[model samples]
Target: MFRILLGREGRVWREALAAVLAAEEDLEVVAELAHTDEVPVVAARKRPDVVVLDHALPGSLTVPDLCEKLGAALPGSVVLVLMDQRGGALSTALARLAPRVGVLTTDATPWQLVESVRQLVRGETVLDAKVAVAALTARDNPLTDRERDVLRLAADGAPAKEIATELFLSAGTVRNYLSRVIAKTGARTRIEAIRIAQASGWI
Candidate 1:
């Protein structure tokens, strides 16, 4: 059987999708997670052959970090991410992961989702055409991965000290990161930086 791990927030949709994938004769739903924080832990333990993840799965870690963590934990596994938007930090991150990563909009039919998983296992890159085009044409995100991480926390209204505690960095380092984020976004203040990043879909 082709083992599958699923990570998505909505209980109804998650369970329904699990049922569909599980119905396949050669596919099995080995694990499911509603939060991004649990994904790395469960995925590491389960070692599934494929991971079907939702881009907006709620948790502390950003989508990029979650994807990076997944890649590190299961380098050989394929990740099929269900996304809403076509381009941004999330798509950029997924693109960097290349053939091991597959993306489809949340509106993708269940049949498309199933076929994409099989294609991924067969070593074919699967990307929605519009998603691929937007990812390629979208302006590159100016912030590095670390900058984006710090900015995501800041966007959540976390103070530098709290951000430091969460990220295991010193308060001063967090402030520096915030400063760089502000400068990179060309914002005169922290709040403005947060707004700019959000509007640009960088965070």
Candidate 2:
């Protein structure tokens, strides 16, 4: 039998998911967690075969960072992250977990979750088709490479002169780049432009 742990926050939602997984004759629900901090203690004690976690949690921390630690705590157990959207706020960095971590969107049926748990136990990567399509269909970044570079620094509150020094450009040129970036991002100020780009996953 495959021992499973539910690491989502909501009681009702966790129970609902538990009911779905319980139907699998080969899968067993061993524990449930409402917080990321509880994962290490429970996984160490239960040593479950799989962990089903929701990408959104109560704390300011992200589930991806928690996944790294959970994977390390139980080397034998693999993580399956459920995304609420076609593609969650998943950083481009999530590609690193492609081998041992699985990602499924919220629209997934109960059977898909069950099968994904079995597949993870078998050591397979499970990624939703919507994830692929979302990546492909994302709005293209409108900023030029240099503009992106400048905006990256500007986003961190660096002034034009400081940014110019870092990129080895003239201070006047850096200001010009910031102006163009603000216009392209359709923001009234450099700060607003940086915010827009960051929100869009461009920076």
Candidate 3:
């Protein structure tokens, strides 16, 4: 049997996923975690073969950090992301974290979920074709490389001065890049501009 750890913040989804996995003859859900911070601990304890994580977890634990931590703790374990239909940005971000990660739509049938789990257990990465195409087509990056670097740092809630220091540019230069990004994305403020850029896969 393939041991699994399910992670989700919402009670309803957690229960539903547990039930689905329990019905499988070759899968066993050994732990269910409610917070991202709990993942590493529980996974370490249970030594699960795969971890199924919901994208909507709380706290400052970004998906990348979660994947890295889990991989470090359990070298051979696979991390699969459970995302909603609209979670394009989150999918993109998670893709950058680990190559073994895959995204599955929440609306997928229980059979699909079980099959995906089986694929992960066999060291295969499985992303729905539609989600992969949508994510790739959405990669309409309009900003220049430098502008994207500035925008990404800004989106992480960094100040203009700090971003300038990190990017080795003057603060005024960073401001200029931000202005152009704002105009290009048709956003009224820096935060809105970052949001638009991220949504469109420009950052």
lDDT per prediction? 0.83, 0.77, 0.78
Q: Could you tell me the TM-score of candidate 1?
A: 0.74
lDDT of 2 by residue, 1-203 (tens): 98898988789999999989988899899998887667778889999888888865433235667778877878888888887443323633344687578888778999899998888888887888876555455466787756777876787788889888877789999999999998898999888998887667565
Q: Which portions of model 3 miss their true places by more than 4 Å?
A: 96-99, 139-186, 189-203
Q: What is the C-alpha RMSD of each candidate to the true structure, in Å?
A: 3.5, 9.4, 6.9
Q: What's the true lDDT of residue 197 in model 3? A: 80
Best by TM-score: 1
> What ranking of all candidate models by TM-score puts the best one first?
1, 3, 2
TM-score of each: 0.74, 0.66, 0.69
How big is the positional error of residue 108 in model 2, measured in Å on the Cα after superposition?
0.3
Sort the predicted structures by lDDT, highest score first.
Answer: 1, 3, 2
By the TM-score metric, which is better: model 1 or model 2?
Answer: 1
Candidate 1 off by > 4 Å:
9-20, 23-25, 34-41, 56-76, 156-166, 169-175
Model 1: lDDT to the true structure: 0.83
lDDT score, candidate 1, position 14:
95
Of 1 and 2, which scores higher on lDDT? 1
Task: Tell me the lDDT of model 3 at 26.
Answer: 86
Say which prediction, candidate 2 or candidate 3, comes out ahead on TM-score.
3
